[model samples]
Target chain A: MGPLFPQEIIGEELNILIGFFIGIGFGFLLEAAGFTNTRKLAGVFYGYDFVVLKVFFSAAITSAIGLFIMNQYGIIDMSAIFYPKTFWIPTLVGGLIMAFGFIIGGFCPGTSMCAAVTGKIDAMVFIGGALIGVFFYAYTYEPLWKELRDSGAMGKVNIAEWMGIDSGLFILILTLIAASAFYAVTIIQKKVTAKGDYQI
Target chain B: MERSKKYMNPYLAGILIGVFMIAAYYFSGEGLGASGALKSVVVATTDMVAHDYATEHSYFSARVSDPENPPIKTWLVFEVLGVLVGAIISAAFAGRLKLETIKGPNVTTKTRFITAAIGGLLFGIGSQLGRGCTSGMVMSGMGVLSLSGFIGLMAIFGGGYVLAYFFRKLWI
Candidate 1:
């Protein structure tokens, strides 16, 4: 009944058009939330501003809950949605690499695009760096990363099922944790930035 | 001219983003992704430049073999283009569109720009290896309770915390 493109409820052109609109909304929100500010983005790790944490956790929980409720009501086919397959070793190592990138750069791929479009010169440099990295990987694919890339093939697995819990219950618990995190971080932000004068 | 404007409330912005993410799933049967779009762009461009080599290489082969399903004709690519448009609009409305480098007072613009480039390069390589970035693998995966998403979340956030201190000069 849903997933218009997959179901042919919408044509290819319209489907992509919708994607374009949605992407714009996503990008707009990222910039509007101060994600364009490198200092604000990096503050998550420094215990200063918690906007990144708050927004990320809240958005995650909100989507989780919304999807669960929709699935329970059969509004969307939860089973058909594209879920990423787990490759534990690569993801762990890759994530670590990305983490370093985040702290040093103060933006991820998505946020960097946001900042770049909004006139952040630093983000422009970051994009150049990303292009170079992509080219490097492409050139050295056979020798450097091909093997490690395909290692630890676990296929697609759901965490809720792996943890032996109902999906709904897991969503609820995650929501609670996020709410608690928001509360804790608000206090931490106050304490950390109280007199620092790290004005944006 | 007006001073740079204030940002939106994080919670409210998060909700709007969350709704869009959900809508994306329902419409396309897919999650939000940014890096994949870039990868597609890279693949398409490379294929065009070196058709024989592109078809021969393992990385570009899968995308190139399917003549009907070119990488450039993908949903994420269009979505990303929209992201640029949307971001520009929002920046314009807020009077935040200015040509400047976002950095800390402690760091020179040159230093900040260099580090940002290096960071972006690493992220680009890592995303290819990991099969996704924060939005694709972590956030979208988590929406459906995928274990990989949790792993990505842990690795990226954990990794950031571990490295943040060493990179403090670049930021604070």
Candidate 2:
């Protein structure tokens, strides 16, 4: 009944069409959550604004909970969908590099796309830089990056299974952690803003 | 500057985003992803400019050869197209739709732009190396309890906190 694309319940065009609509919602929510603002995103690290953290955790946990329950009830086939593979070494190194991008660029790939579309000049420039980066990678793959990117291949491991815990229980624990962090961040944001209100 | 409407509460926005994500899984059989388009654009553009090189390259060959899902016709490309439209609509509705450069007060426009370019360049390479960006890898991956996603989540955020002090002037 679900995963219409893989099940042949829908054609590729329809799948792509539906994806487009869903992306609209994603973009709308992103902008509505103040994600277009670099300052808002940067605030999470600086303790000045936690909208990024709050929205991010809430979205992730909510999707986790919702999808997990849906899977339990047999509404959607998790296996029929595209799931990302785990590459610990490269992921760690790449993620660290992206962290510098986040702090310096003030936007991740998604947020930057949305921001650039909505007319942020710096975002447009950032897109240019990303294009160049991708080109550089594509050209130099054989010599410079191929090996490192392909390292540490652990195939499709779920964290819950790896930890020897129930998926539901793991999600519950994650939710609690996110909730507590939300509470703590709210307080930190208050203290930081109270100290001095800076403009973004 | 013109005043814009206040943003929606973060919690509610998060809920809406979750609903959309679930819908994506239900219909398209994918979760939130936004960086694939960047790669696609690169592949397509490269294919056009240097067809021989693109076709021969290991990185771009598979994408270029796949007729059923050509580089430009990928799901993420359409999705990102919609993101652009949706973002434009939302920004317009919020009265925040305008062309401007955002930067910290302490830094000049030159420094800010240069920093942003370098950051974007690094992120582009990292995303390709890691197989996805924040949304495609970490956010959606973690939602499904994938170890890769969780690892990325910790790395990016943890790394950010560690480096924030050094780059404080950039933002603060």
Candidate 3:
């Protein structure tokens, strides 16, 4: 019933247009939440600011719960959407690499775009780096990455399934975990900012 | 004129972002992504400059739809473009729009830029190898409760924690 574009519920051109509008809203919230600020983003790792952690975890849980409920109510066909296959090894390795990038570079690709728009010089540099990285990966993909990329192919296994538990229970546990993390970070933020006149 | 404005409450912002992600899935049958859009740009550029080479290349060829139509004409690209505009508007409203380099107090601007570039390059390569970035892989993957998402979450966040000390000078 939903997923207007992929399901052909809406015209192709209109779907793209909708994508544009939705992207704008997504970007706006990212920036308004101070995602463009490298320091704020960095704070998640450092315990000075927990905004990134709070925002990221909350969003994921919210979406998960919403989708689950929507699917249950028959409002949307969750199966029709493109649920990415679980390539565990590559994803783990890749995520580790990206994490290193985030710590060193202080911006993810999406946040960097937001930062770049607001005239952050570092964000621009990150953009250049991303392009170079893309080119590098592209050129060496077949030789260096192709095999590893296909490793650990656990084809579309949900986390709940893998854990041998109910999705609702998993989500509830996740939500509780997220809430605790948010609370812990708030405490850490107070402690971290207490000793110094840090201007974040 | 005044000091920078405070950002939106993190929880509120998270819920808003969550709603957006849901909207993305509902309307487009996809979730939000930033890196995949960038990949399309890279592929399109490479194809435009070196058509024969692009066709021969494994990655480009894998995703190439029409040989004539540009690879950049995809959903993520337009979505990313909107992200830029939206971020700008938000910044303007908040008065946080400034031209500055962000880094740790000890880190030099030159060092920051260099690291930013290197980090970005690493992220770009990793996203392709891993098949998504934080937004695309980690966030969206988590939404569907895919094991890939959790693995990615651990990798990126856990990896960051592991590497943070080494790069402490960059952000601390």
Candidate 4:
């Protein structure tokens, strides 16, 4: 009954409309969580503020738990979704590249978009650069990136299944880990900020 | 100038976003994403300008080759459009809308802009290779217990921590 769009239980127009509303909520939460602030986002890595960690892990745990329960009750079919394949090699390399982007650019793609719309000048320039980059990639896809992009194909696998553990149990473990990390970050934040103020 | 309202509690905002994620999956059979829309928009724009070139290119062709379903006409694109709208509304109500460059006190506007441009360029390339950006790949993947999500999570933040010291002047 769930995943209404794929099943055609919902019309295409309706599904798109729903998606827009969801995006609005997503953007709102992102800005409200202070993710639009580069200083605040950077704080997670610098040990000054841990808001990013708190929000990220909290959201992940929440979604995992919610999905698990919904699947248990047959409320949604997890198999129907646009599941991602694992391109381990590319992901690793790409992730490192993105990491540098985060440090130097001061915003991720989503946050940059949100910040750009809210009148962040740097974010506007960042988006401009991204557009050029995307265009460049498309032009050079076959010659330069085709090989690396398609490398290391592990199809449709997840952590719980790979570990040979139940999804519910794995989520429980993840929640526990996140909880401890949340606690640990709080303590770390206090120590770091004690040395000097962190202004965002 | 009126100061911006205090941000919503981080955990609360996270929970609300998580709820939105669940809804996204339920309604559309996927999670939140940002980069996919970027790709779509680019492909569509390219196709609009030069239909033959876009449809012939290996990467753009995948979407642009389909005449009936143009690259821009998709759920992700609409969702991203809504992100812009929603961000505007939120910033408006919070009194946070202003034009300014965000940077460290020590950094010049020129240096920050140059870094920002380079950073964005790299991120665009990375997201294409990795198949998604932060929201789409790592976090949403993890929501479904995907291994790629965990690997990406580690690679991103782990790499960030490993490299943070070098970029200390950029933020701290």
- Per-residue lDDT of candidate 1, residues A105-173 (tens digit): 788888888889889999989888887878788878889888998898888888988999998888888
Report the error of model 2 at residue B112, Å. Answer: 1.1
Model 3 misplaced regions, further than 4 Å? B65-69
List candidate 4 segments past 4 Å from native.
none
Residue A136 accuracy (lDDT) in model 3: 92
Residue-wise C-alpha lDDT for candidate 4, range A78-105, written one tens digit per residue = 9998677898999998898888888888
Ranking by DockQ: 3, 2, 4, 1
Clashes of each: 0, 0, 0, 0
- lDDT for each residue of candidate 1 in B50-113, tens digit (9 for 90 to 100): 8898888898899989988998999999998988898999999999998899787799988998
How well docked is model 3, in DockQ terms?
0.83
Docking class of 1: medium
Per-residue lDDT tens digits of candidate 4, residues B63-147? 8767778888889988888888888888888988888888876788998899889989988988888888889998899888888
Candidate 2, Cα interface RMSD? 1.0
> 1 or 4, which is superior by lDDT?
4
Choose the strongest candidate by DockQ: 3
Error of 4 at A34 (Å): 0.7
Task: In candidate 4, list every pair of residues with a backbone clash.
Answer: none
| Model 3 Cα lDDT, one tens digit per residue, B5-110 | 8899888988989998999899998889999888898898887788888888788886664755467877888889888888998999999889988788888888
